[model samples]
Target: MIKDKYTYINREISWLQFNARVLQEAEDESVPLIERLRFLGIFSNNLDEFFKVRYATIKRIEEAGKAARSELGGYAASELLEIITQIVIKQQSESLDILNKIHEKLEDENIYIVKEDQIDESQHSFIKNYFIQHVSPALVTIVLSDQVDLPTLKDSAAYLACNMKLLDGKCQYALIEISRTMDRFVVLPKKDNIDYIIMLDDLLRYCLHDIFSIFEYQDITAHMIKITRDGELDFDSDLSKSFIEKISDSVKHRQIGEPIRFVYDKTIDEETLRYFMDKMSIETNDSVIPGGRYHNRRDYMDFPSLGRTDLLYDKISPLPVKGLSLERSIFSTIANKDYLVYTPFHTFSYIVKFLREAALDPKVKSIKITIYRLAQISHVASSLINAAKNGKKVTVAIELQARFDEQANIDYAEQMVSEGINLLFGVRGLKVHSKMCVIEREEEDSIVRYGFISTGNFNESTAKVYTDFTLLTADQRILKDINKVFNFFETNYKIFRYKHIITSPHYTKSRFFKMIDNEIENVKKGKPAFIKIKLNSISSYMMIDKLYEASRAGVKIQMIIRGLCCLVPGVRGMSENIEIISIIDKFLEHTRMLIFCNNDDPKVFISSADWMTRNIENRVEVTCPIYDNDIKQELMDIFEICWNDNVKARILDETQSNIYKKNDLPKVHSQFDTYDYYLKKLQS
Candidate 1:
């Protein structure tokens, strides 16, 4: 239970709880064995990023001598830092236990994850040959000494710290960086129909003598250590450099950013640990977590399948949208009515098809879209280039500061510029986070507009795993508003009024508040009033307060939040009418949808904005109203499917205990049921 003094959960604490839910998936017996290992990878990866970004921010706040109590959800900056460290240590220990259990289970299935010490004579030749051919060339080793200052470690990169006692009683220290390019899991030749896998770390450990063959040392030992540096990009006021150049420079500087978290193998010698800590100047108050034998467990995300389909989740074929054909003229069909494309269930080809159609269509004159993060080899970028080659005036407003994707976006931006496509770097202050597209086609003596607005990125790779809604429509009202957004991108000084869609940096907060107020008034008038919301996260206290006010006014609110939520629900006389659950399943729950009971008429919206502070007041985001009756109902149906999920959904409350939602109702695995729901729609 929350203390009576506070009305909200700390966002950082809530985020840790969310990661705990992910860890729970790894612990779940029902989850497939290999997939459970992958969940451990995800958990480790999430914690690494949390330390790099969120925890680093709090450290900065504390260093700047600011209490930041309200900003940190009522906890002092120093207090929150200590709390986060304790929670992370506990989680790291739990993850290591889970990893051990998974290894045992894998062994049960005849898949032995062999250690360096367990290498047999038959495997010896293969390991030696593999290291010489593959690992030897890419291996980067640094010799550490008192005379030379230790080089700054790359952020989140794992290293094997070496301590060697020489024959003369003197010691030599060295560091060996784990290569990111090589595969972390090396599959050995199978025998007796049994599979064998060795981790790159253990492989290095086995080859340590070879790595240090030149050193005349009596005894040598290596332990894994990793450093997570602050990830915030800092730009200098250089008047001559372009935005892309500045971002590129800042990204390079991030390699040596202030260290926030230092994770080392618990069994490392005290002398070695102390020497490195003194060299790196890591303060005592900084987050120094003692972990298991291996660091950078994020590599387990790519744990070799080894043809073990039985040990992994069954892969489902992506279904096609009922009436939408990839070969047909998407423009012709969507021009008449809006069609909703929910990804992972519905194929993402519809999005590529829309762009491909716009590229080849002779009548199309211009195309405008917002680009955030694109796939490594994006077909979306190729299609946009093809459109530009066809003489269609293509304007792309790609965000350069999309957080960790700055370099990828910069590369694509330069390529687009060379192709003669007009590019907008977005508004000077705001990040253009809206995912939308508009195409103007000269048809029947009047220009007709067709477009799509999505709650996720236009990247096809993420589209396969992230559940997002894309409304493909030729609704002139909505398209006109989309055009205004592009215009805002080019000329940001003038804020345009959007009649059909709510936009951020100026209108989202107030507009959402007005809608919540309407719900409050409706409940007072004895009209059907409720609010159903699905989002990746909600940290905006302003938005949470509005919901709390509506709840106090007797409005029923059901929320499906996939990540951190600050609002403390189920509190009497405060938020008793509010209930929230987080669903973490096979596909990431990323669709941001809102359904307001506007006197039973219902107002539905699909948005590129979450209820986070940045999405509301800092970034350029869009919340496009769902006007098509069928599409709106389809979204509502999916929301209900997720809300009714009893298997993966975790109830959110003051206690931060991620208890799975269960009941006597028939079992509903929402992710699977959602796929089935679409399949049945096609059958119907």
Candidate 2:
């Protein structure tokens, strides 16, 4: 297959479309008003990260003189960058319009988002006092002048650019950092059963004179400007430094990474905008986005609900897995048969219960786990520490380079060390992106292994909103492979073989390629052959080519990819047998699962990997095969439920239009139906 014939979407363009789906949620009328607003916030937040990581990467590629067009899925880096900028500018404008529409609808419900100028006499005292107490001390305001270079602007932080005209006709400029310590949305005192809210931005706008009373300004204007810098950490060649030390230094340096994007209020004066462009050194190729008055709209994600249950999605109590019990030993349940825990549908407490049980279980001799990102207040860390406190040997391979989570993981690593838990900073070049845990327990006459593997982080906070699968099993074949992974962390020189679980940086690519080839061969013999995959992304060209090979051989392929799928599906002769859909709704579609119809007998696996080159060859990831027949059926059923969803699922095609899969059949809102599927199983 020549590079020219390989048809795949540019990952950057695909990612922008994924975010547009998020924006679609904000635009969807059926979504609860509060959730739609929060979706807009999520959309904004997702864009920030994209600019920092993906967009920044493409900028570097363009600077390196265009050698990686094949790698970028046939689009030139410079061309892709321009296309991304134009798409974002258009989305940013649409987001502003959507926000306005939401606000108007909010007013229909007597929930007014009153600006500083819109605030009446009834709200003045509250706003003034709120500003004095909450906003004043937390604020970081800087005055700007031509004589001084701008303070190293923090990446992804929103700042208000002020253009003040003094009584003497002298112009002064300033930048005010929005207080992260305070809520961006301030709820004012209620009047006549009507609620009024003011954004911190507008509150600051109202108090401009008070903020600069000493300046004697005749006029003042402020507009939001947010700059995103490259988030890639560049470690120095300091050999003697500890991994933690290196990570700390790199995080500090990340604040000063070259700017990849500069977003400002579209209505800001040309003079102010140009001053920002020149002073900030925003490059000609760097994305210059014209956003609304509110730049860091990610804050809208936490827009206070104002005690309005009617305006929010109905909360469902997380149900328990049919047979797994928090009261009983989780090991005992897994010891019987493999049990899968689908989170948001099933309670996250099972994971905590398992760890806490291990902490207290006398038979449990040792515990080994992998940590990526943890909740701010993590019970998982506490449970592991408890096990260490109880004289059980606890080993943790915490990835210190978990992107934006480096500092948090470092802090937890220090705390775990203080608690006497052995810590591994991951292998030198490969990040430990795999999520698995194995506990060795003293059974009658022999030691037995019990473990769980997950498709997402073990953070309970995210568990509530992100849909993921965690499989609990005492199967020796899978447990042995998991133990080998932990063993490799301690002894990086050894190359271990696996029979049941597929591991990365060694076997994932070859194993998956072999699987795809098997399907293609099976189809050649005129047997039933098909592939089903669910994942967060699939941008790997090698993996894409293999899939195209399978598709060409008439093996049907169905995919539920949540984000950044570069494969150009439904193309004649290239990928006609493949169809992919992405679902974005109340809960993020986060499970990474694969099923293969091998000569009518199915093979199933759940994975902690996307088909990205990073996951396949650059990181330590694990893909565990499902051995238990019942659990395999359960996984298949869940996949079918998502695949059949007409409400939230959107077709992924050559156009990248993100049109929802519409049908006249009885509506299947997959997430809701999935929960009910488990509920019905419990009753039966």
Candidate 3:
């Protein structure tokens, strides 16, 4: 157990601070204008998910009358909910201010984002025609009343709460659902080199007359309001339904789940707000946030570029990995030596190439892979289907519970099943979070195995923007362990021992603890001892305590966590030897890596798991040790580059201030520098 004096930050509160860093990117004038707007959208989207998942979870605990102090890092569930609401309110207000400033900047660049009243003659005809032809058919308008039962509002759907004052003393209230199928941003015809854009909310306000023409109202008003429902899937006890059917039913039921968050425009009139609140049965304890004019500002992520490339960050071409050729046979190459592919810096086509080769090679008799998420247009899925058609035994273990991507995974699973590919839903009560593929081939009168392990999903779309690593090898030892994992998926009753890779829920914590103990022993023996790690988040108390123990033993520790770091770094006698930083930049820092100095002979690993309890104890994750000396050096070099980043890196200290790492040395933008590093290696 971690001592109370160790000082752990609440995960929810730390996540809010991470979003605050996103808001900082939006407010940063040094960033490109259009990219800054997208950052604002990203900030809003992150908050929406936080409420739906984290905040909803806490609300459930409060309703259950559980303090949950220990689970929540010492704060009671009710207390944490109040703190989250207050922090979110401040963030929302700051985001609105940032949006206003961005709008002013856009105006300076001859890009005017106009309101309903700002529509001029040049855009008037276009708006009317566009609405009649495109939006009118898609619109869902409900005329609400007290006499009739209110319809259950769609979760997270933006609605214009319409208040109409009739000629008589009575009033009519209606809600117009914004058509999600249509573009949230509508661009108007340019006039004299000046570009004009308007949000869909303003467009709806302008067309209110056309919508409610029969109401005979003297005046009408519309303000945006949105509700976020609890997103946790509650399974049914139906025995007859298949696993897929149960999951599908749960996803459908999510729409009517209890409300956890309600956001509305502060400018909205009191009568309308109260009426809707009462009708929706919103309680005072619910997260009722007063927001800006727009509710779903996440739509700003898709704000049209308008062909102004100058106003956006310049796109960099993904580089080719050294010694890896997409045109060559990946199996033949990996048989010789293990190679690492770092994505976004390097093109993701190598992964696709590997799968395609496995599909066509006649000697390749079988393929096994674990998938968490796939791209919408997944070449990886197509390749697997192709392998199945070519008489290869292809077995896929696809996770259907990848949050927010569940429906997409379900659709892909059905398609794969139809194509004659064997699908496994993974072991009961354990999520298959590992990203790995193993294949067997007939080689010179004997069977040989080849495979790849990754720190991310094999999704091509995300691979373009998420920094991840994939290691390809033909090592028999590692491939044997990979095969054993697939067997466990098939027959989970028998727990198997793995000699090479670390598997979660059975071995990850113990293995890591042993490794840390080795480092501590080396420190005591007067040898160089240090630990370096990179992960998206770390919150497990046992893991944090182990690091504290190592720190107290005089072993230096450095961490680069992208989000949700709960351990209080730099606390004397607790984590005095520990320092942490987080990098928020163009590409998400998603790779999980660990390095330990065992008497100067370093041991390095890349994993799918973070230090969170779910990953360590509930999910089936894999941590693969880097055996190739070259790849080990490459990983260490990249970590050092990121550690020394003066730009985009924020020191994650006790204050949670998100201060940038700055020094007198020449600026090192790690993302750009890493790309250059790979480019130079390719040239060499």
Candidate 4:
């Protein structure tokens, strides 16, 4: 390892290490079988995105021939690429091992995932009928014979590369696109209390002759292949177009982005692979991963919840916030005092209830919100439309550049616009990622604004599985600054100053640095100096350096980073005072919280931004201080529970080994413990 005084771990490599921890979840036999499979699917999906975005970016930097070592903070882009490739290869092998073990365990449970050759006569008939009815019409096959240019492969979908031997001694290659229109797992007829599952690819393999019976191929072989393309949005610097139009154009351009990686079955023919490599102009330097016959395991995320509810995690009903009812007017409750909504634990319906109340309440004059991503059939959008239809002014700042969801956001924007809602696409050069909603009420000759700020999206569908914090407050000081942020989105040229809110692209980084500096000063004064932060990612080198400085200054630091942490904690004399842990549990830990011991007068903040560079300087984000005593205590309680977690919490050390926290105390699983903690609160 290269050692330098100020240098730290490379962010990309650290991200791979974080993903390894996720893969470890699959290897843990104590987890439920289906949950373990879902973890593997998550690992696969995460790696696909890492290749598409981070790996692709580094590849571009390497290709540009610039000295990216300094830009990356320690290692060159070329070196990082090699490191990533090695780490990913190891993790992929581990994933296969875990999958084999899971398969064995599944057999013990009387469920079998069978291949094409293992099918019985009954299964054969069932699969044949299933394929012809469901999979055949959606299958698009292309014959490769040097007469046609290679087809443009989709990044999100997988293809079956077929090698066929005809009766005339001629060899041919063909492609079969896996149909996303159909489910990836096909459940077969049960025999003798034994359940059987077959991959959609194998089902296609079983019926391949029927699919190509008209072509008269005697021998055939099908291998799965998947391509990952660069997902960067390339927007033209055209002055005539609006920002929304540029984002739309960039979204379209992303469909044909350069291929970054090609993953194929290990048993694929060398000749066919070479033909594909030559046609696609893919050099050996590009990632060409060899794997099992099935690719795109992300589809397993939807793996047929299949009436086997007993085999999955018991569904927990999201509880209502204590003393906050959906039937009553949400505005009236907020008008009385500030409230907090902890999601997945507390129902996300309060947000919807707030909007619904605004839609019908005559005293409410206007509603405004900044939306990053909304659900497919969003009640949020419906409520906004209802407000607009009821003659209440509704303004929505909808981000049309939420990656992979750009089309959905664009559709929502158009629908809202047609419904007389004042829809603002987003800022010119920045994504509006902050989740904030404001309702202006015409109460007693003065307009009062009531709303909430969150650390996650306004998406109700995701709220069930994502752990996030949302604060509902009628505090005018914070809402006034929120209004300023909306104004910044509208005007784009006005320079707004905020005192109570930390707005990004201008204030987030500097303000956070100042907070760290304050902690450093407190340490020097012999006062209680400590900092606790919880975020999704901590990849920004500058922020990491600030924390390192604080660690050197004798200020205790505790971090609960759920993903992509670049700082290596517990290094003697470098970061000995700092401890870092990551929790991967049932719900995605998405809340961003920061607590600083300002000489025992603690300051707590809930933010929509992580410590990553993208969140601090490139996107629009907000970090609001928690002022209410009850809410501050609630946030602290949740953070402390996560911090004390020995189960499911992994230490982030320099080795990137993802070692679980070991102690002699009784086991405490944070996610379940947190749910019970809130349940007790409701009872009391």
- Whole-model lDDT values for every prediction: 0.93, 0.92, 0.93, 0.87
Ranking by lDDT: 3, 1, 2, 4
Give the Å shift of residue 65 in candidate 2: 2.1
In candidate 2, clashing pairs total 0
The better-scoring model by lDDT among 1 and 2 is 1
Instruction: Report RMSD (Å) for each prediction in the order shown.
Output: 1.4, 1.2, 0.9, 1.7
TM-score for all models, in order of appearance = 0.99, 0.98, 0.99, 0.97
Model 3 per-residue lDDT tens digits across residues 580-637 = 9999998889999999998889999999999999999999999999999999999999
The alpha-carbon deviation from the true structure for residue 303 of candidate 1, after best TM-score superposition, in angstroms, is 0.5
Task: Give one digit per residue, the lDDT tens place, for model 2 in 171-246.
Answer: 8999999877789999999999999999999999999888988898888999999889999999998989988999
Alpha carbon lDDT at 226, candidate 1:
94
In model 2, the runs with Cα more than 4 Å from the true position are 4-6, 283-285
Candidate 1, superposed: residue stretches over 4 Å from native: 1-5
Cα-based RMSD of candidate 3: 0.9
Candidate 1: Cα lDDT at 467: 94
Worst 10 residues of 1 by lDDT: 1-10
What is the Cα-based TM-score of model 1? Answer: 0.99
Residue pairs clashing in model 1 are: none
Better of 2 and 3 by lDDT: 3
Residue 612, model 3: lDDT of 98
Error of 4 at 315 (Å): 1.3
> Model 2 Cα displacement at 304 (Å)?
0.3
